[model samples]
Target: MFRVSLLFLILGFTCLSCKSEDKNNVGTTEENIDALLQARYTKLLNYDVDSTAFPRSYSPEKKQIKQVPSKDWTSGFFAGNLWQIYKLTGDSRFKQRAKQWTAFLEKEKFNGRTHDMGFKVFCSFGNGLSVEDNQNFKDVIVKSAKTLSTRFNENIGSIRSWDFGKDRWQFPVIIDNMMNLELLFEATKISGDSSFHKIAVKHANTTLKNHFRPDGSTWHVLDYDTISGQVRGRVTHQGINDDSSWARGQGWAINGYTMAYRYTKDKKYLDRATATADYFIHHKNLPEDGIPYWDFSHPDIPNVSRDVSAGAIVASGLVELYKYTKNDTYLNYSKKVVNSLKTEHYILPKDLEVPFILDHSFGDWSKRHEMDEPIVYGDYYFLQTLLRLKEID
Candidate 1:
């Protein structure tokens, strides 16, 4: 299942052949990706979707579109992807559609049960705020940050990542939680409350101290002892095993710490970002095209599925890291990812009726779900990387 079906492969080839003979005459690779996005999302806007449902991924086996309720961690990504496209292309249609989709997620600002406030609120409302000045958007962001802060235990110095699996994990924190700090940092900037910033810094510092191994690879989850304020267990919920590196977790660390550095000007955060970025790009198991296997230490190795979502996330993070370090290595690696992603091998076939723009994103390996599917978050970060590349170009 790692390979696209022969039918889709043929469709992709035909789609590629239909393009203009001169690639430069059409536009830059980034611009072309934007154009493809414009076409695909315009088609998606035409679909009659359920008001309460948000697109999650395309199930190639059942040939059904997977959707989730607004509270789902991925609900905001579709709107965020639309907002990013609008920002990149200045297309008002995308902006209008983005606003409509983003409106459905407003209720999530008060849903504090999960630590994905930034992934939900920030990616949707935060990107909306960046594209246009809306006071309501700013208020939602601040409120969401406050809601997220409720999960932070002062003793643990980290936000609780999962409310489920209580029988297995007591006060568990995942590396993905690091990414939600952007909401806290931005809330402090908007509301002038340093409490949010302080909590974010403490969480980042704690993660720095405990989450990483000597090789710069990260463990996916850490369970903390609330009474003693010490890490009780280090494990992986999504990797090959407890000791392997999950590809997307490393991407989250790079992205999270780079944003932390941007807010605090702390060299430690930057250094952590650099170390993880180096580990990701230079890992012996990484493919030449810059995409990584779902788990770097998987026994299957070259036979494993590639996670385009991870590549897209890391590329966008490196784009930001490059802005700070002025290091071409970071930029070049990002460019390689972007270039590989824009090719027909990764892009959704033109004749495919799905809403996603790219394919081959592996989502939870432990459950064997969403393997080699076109996921909304993959397209979200793919667009983000495109916009970031355009910004720095």
Candidate 2:
């Protein structure tokens, strides 16, 4: 018999209390939702200690990984999310931690040399600390923005990725870079400079023209020759090769374009966001729990691993898309994914040992060690999606 007991338990824990309110009669009230989110936020914040500048992923159940530098980019991403929550709740504790995090990054000499510098510095220093008008942070953002702007090559019309062995090849621009373009845009806003905005627009246009496929899916990486400004190769960082679609890469494109639209108000960006989202939603390969296999084109299904992190990121992007279109379908889809994430497998409830909502996120396919780990990005986006929903309510 299909067990109804487990189903009842899931439903019982899934439905959070909905408080009565006059203004928002359709769903839960904003204040009530904020209170629930605040409780979760408090739990997450309490885990941080002076020994570490930011919250660790979790206390390991087994032997712990060696401690690295306190200023890693992954930790910075979570701090950025926490800063967003602080903005929503107006909590001083969140602000203090955020400040401490930025100070650590500033002192650490974070040069925008890696593809992840945008995710690292832009999210934390640019988005998080900028709101509070911290001069040190403002300078940090300006310096990073200048470094990123300098990375723009007029020949290829896209920012360079890394200083790999050889500089002859123009290298490739990956979809992940979209998250960093906001840094250039912000720089333009702060300095009244058009060059930064121009570079960002060109890069966006180049991605739109080359990176995306007709089916709305995108390549994980695209190599463009610097001298001639021509395409060289398209490859996947997480799949077998260029032909496969890594689910999270697609998620990044969807979320990136949605955010790009917010900055530029370009209808084309929205079109791309919706197109990428459509490809993800319409794909028949999703597991019964709503999470996708790590690679949609992975040869096997039942044997292939799933990435709940992809689901969490895409679910958050879907909510942002809904805000732009005000489409009920998008909102419903976002809610469905969130419900699955909270009830199906990964989410640890209030009484559970862990605080995160999703786990088993794969970071790289080359080495499978990252599989089944609680990725910081997954937790960040999950919190972001829930916070956005609260605002809508």
lDDT over C-alpha atoms for residue 315 of model 1: 94
* Predictions in order: lDDT: 0.86, 0.68
- 48-111, model 1: which lDDT tens digit per residue? 4455778899998999988889999999999998898777667676788889989899999999
lDDT of 2 by residue, 1-393 (tens): 011121101111123333332232233544434333344455545544343545434434553332234445465665676677576666677777666665566543346566555666777787565476766666666666777777788888788765653543457788878877877777777777888788889888888889988999999888887678999878786675679889999888988889889889999999999999989977888776567888999888768878877887888888989999987867777777666655324543333333343456767785544666666677777767776677787
Number of the predicted model whose TM-score against the real structure is largest:
1
lDDT of 1: 0.86
TM-score of 1: 0.91
Number of the top-ranking candidate, with lDDT as the measure = 1
Question: How high is each candidate's TM-score?
Answer: 0.91, 0.82
Clashing pairs for model 1 are none
